[model samples]
Target chain A: MSLIQEVSSFLTHEADLLDQGNFEAWLELYEDDALYWVPSSPEQTDMKGQVSIMLEDVPLLKLRVRRLSHPRAYAVTPKPATIHLIGNINASEEDSLVMVSSKLIMTQVRDNVATSLSGAVTHHLKRSEGGFGIKLKRVDLIEAGGTFSAISVPL
Target chain B: MLTIDEINNIAGVDGMQARAYTDPDIFELEMDQIFRRAWIFIGHDSQVPNSGDFIRTRMGVDEILLVRQPDSSLRVLSNNCTHRGTRLCAVAQGNTKSFVCPYHAWGFALDGVLKAVPDIESYPGSFDIKDKALHLISAARVESYRGFIFASKATAGPNLYDFLGRMTEAIDNLLDRSPDGEIVMEGGHFSVRYHGNWKLHHENANDTVHPGYVHESSVTSARQAEGGVTPQDELVDRGQTKGMMASNGLTAKDWNAIELNGLPQGHSFMGGFYKSGLLAPQQSDAAIETYREALEASHGKEKAAKILGMDRFNNLVWPNLNVNAQFHQIRVVYPVAVNETIIKGYCFRLKGAPDEIFYRAVRFLGTLVSPASMIFSDDLEIFGRVQAGLETGSLDRLDSRRGIKTDQKNGNALQSTTSSELPLRTQSKAWRHWMSPDT
Candidate 1:
């Protein structure tokens, strides 16, 4: 596969793992210093100065995954089954990192209620001997400014 | 519509009727009597620092424009245009000298003065431009306590200070934590709309018991990750522990030490968590030392220690506002319908404090209450379920009778144990008083 095709397939596989509730495998795609961020506002730039919907480091991300996997996770007791449709995948290599951008439409169902969220996803991936690992993953939702209900799972 | 007798029947000293959370008519009555007449927090002074800077917010159902005047004072005007009744400002917040109506091209200044009108001669005689200024319906009373602004629609009532009563101490304690004795709304905001009555948000603010049960999953995970065996671990054996845990670090003794104070004017707060003179763990040792030095410089070390040692949580200021001194964040609850509520959370920065201090506050704001937080998601889930359950009519009365027998009357304030239902009971009493026409 071409480099672009390889990047697209990596993201597609990542989405598959998330949708299948395989959090352990999905988390393996991240490097030790990975940062997962979802900006709260469209103009949000400073993660430290401004509050984001999520700005989790590796430790925080692991805690989130642990909670989600727990059986007593009341927020997701029934578990939100999600399907991620990724399109418009584009990639560019800059130095040792590969920048990839894609649009995502995620539909989640829990307790007979379905919620559709559309957003832009950007990933900064580092090439490893085994495969690629995510250094930074940013998800910017279209409805970031509006009043969103509980965002239980990662986008 | 509900009669006076019916309204009285909905809430009492013991509990409240389920219909209070499901009936549309009762919500309308509450909008008029409680939300409209009472002093409601609109926004912070820092939101509009420059002249002509304005923000659009709501007071109950009515949209309002909070504008900063040339003199740096704020003017709360109706968002509707005087001419043709078009919505004046559509943007959430911006810096604009004048707002022009889209339909008629009529313009009004930041102070609600009618400035310009397109084609002035088009009108017949007797259309005085000066008299036609934006029909500014001023809030009956507008006042600021520290930097927090509150406005009431009723022309006759207690002043904001009188209304706040003992609640002012909570606000004072929050502001005093700042070295310079002031705070600014720094981080933007996180808004979440829940399928629950607005009252549920207020009630949950002082709820000390729900954290253990509702946040069981997070607590269990945090404990298991720290190599501590949680009670739930026996249910599901997930081996392999030892990692950085994400727990509140609150022990059973700490939980038992928490005291719930029922203040007058329907306000209450939970205390006894941060008696060691720190709000949460400081981000870094450098930040902690810098903040402490600043505090010591402004106020004497002894006084600053006392200010920092004030352990308060979830100061519910009746009807709508919830202030957290620990994190320096304010949450306002807005009722959209009987079964729908919107909550807006704002995190503030202590003026003259270190950058890490503000960052720590923002982190707390995001990880504790924001929609993305697992902790808050659990509460929202329960709130949504409660609203749905109330609609089913299975339970006629919602209980608020815990710790009532142990409550001690101290002046205007009623003190109770940590896990008491006194806060909810006090809130219901105040709700009943405000909802009554005679009051």
Candidate 2:
């Protein structure tokens, strides 16, 4: 497959895992050192000094996934239905690794409220034995500085 | 419009009227009486330390600009332009030479004086730029207590310190924590909105009984984290995140052991660092050690220990602000409407403290206050459910009579059981006090 096709397919598979509530499988797609970042400010780049909306490593992500499945996690008790639509894919590959950028419009519907979040997503995919492992997944939300309710589900 | 008697009757001894949280008219009255009359926290002096520096904030329901005057004094002015009631400055925060209205070229000085205007021939013969009416509306009183700024529209009630009362210690403790005895609001903030009454946030904050129940999922998830060999870097990550989530899992005995103090003026706080837990106030990491030595150098060892030993969970200043002094964070609540509220969480950077300690503060803030936080999301969920339930009007009033009979007077404030609903009652009583007619 072409670089664009391969990257697009990879993102699709990843989104399918999240969209279908297959969190356990989704965890395997990330490298141990992978970073899942959602900056709180539009111009924010550093997480150490400035707060981020979501800055989770693998361990935190696992904890989050576990909470989502917990019976008492009332925020996700109804189970939000989400469609993570990726478009405008731009991919460049070299040395068995791919650098990909895309636009993500993820819409989550739960308890009759449909909330849509759009962001520019950057992915660093490391070449691995079985497939590519996500080294970094940074999503800069368009409304990074806007007010929000509890975003119980992962984006 | 609710008469003062009707409004006072809303928040009574045993319970509060459901309309207190659901009615738009009552919300407006609250903006007028409680918010406008009381000392409402605006911005920190650290935010705008120099002249021309300013931050946009809200007083009651109206937008206001908290600016530093050319002489370095702070000024709180209504953000609306006097000409057409349009917003004078749309920027969230910035240093400015002057505020020029975007609609018309009417410029105002940093002190809110009408400086200049455009279209000389467009106005009526009575137009006078020098008139005070043409300038931005200013708050009747603006004062700062230890860099924490508060504004009062009424300008006749208690001064900032008097209004802060025992709550001043919460601010003092935060300031004293700094090795250099200074702190600045450095990190960006999280602005979170919930479709719930603003009171629910603070009411839930110091309520020891709700953490174990409202955040059971996160607690259980933390306890059930994979127990196999963890990676080296993930250890610190697991420790802090796990500690924060599990801290809410305190047993009933432990929760009861935690002392809750409700002061006059609706202020309350929780103390008693758990005797055993990851969040134990005594726990010292390398970062903490470094921070301690720095603090010791600035303040002698005894003073440093006293400062560090001041363990507090939530120091709630009535009606709006929640100061977590030990954690170096504060959450400010803004009432958007009857059923809506916005909360902004900010962490302070202690001057002369090791970067590691500040990083932990930043991390602690994210773990606890972020909208995506494991513990906080549940709280927000509960708040939404509360609002939804209250809007149904299934009940006329909400109960708050827990541990009231057990309360004993300590100084001028009422002291009650640690896990009781004393904070709620204290808040409601103050609500009644501020909502009543000024005789």
DockQ metric for all predictions: 0.49, 0.63
Model 2 segments beyond 4 Å from truth? B120-125, B227-238
Query: Quick one: best DockQ, which candidate?
Result: 2
Q: How do the residues A1-155 of candidate 1 rate in per-residue lDDT, one tens digit apiece?
A: 88889999999999999999888788899987688889888856887788888876665667789999888778898899999999999999999999999999999999899998889999999999877999889999999988888988787
Top candidate (TM-score): 2
| Runs with alpha carbons beyond 4 Å of true place in candidate 1 | B1-4, B113-134, B226-253, B275-284
List TM-scores for all candidates, in order: 0.92, 0.97
Local error of candidate 2 at B121, Å? 5.1
Highest-lDDT candidate: 2
Interface alpha-carbon RMSD, every candidate: 8.5, 2.5
Could you give candidate 2's per-residue lDDT for residues B1-439 as a string of tens digits?
5677786679878889898999998899899988888999998989999999999989778899999998888889999999899987888999998998899888899999998888767888898887888888788899999999999888588888998998999999999999988999988888888889988988999898988888999999989887443453332343677788988888888888777788889999888855555583778777888889999999999999999888778999998999999889999999999999999999999999998777778888888888899888888888999999999999899998888787778998987656789899889988888888862
Please write out the lDDT profile of model 1 over residues B166-237, one tens digit for every residue: 778878987888998888998878899899999999888787777777877887776654333433222112
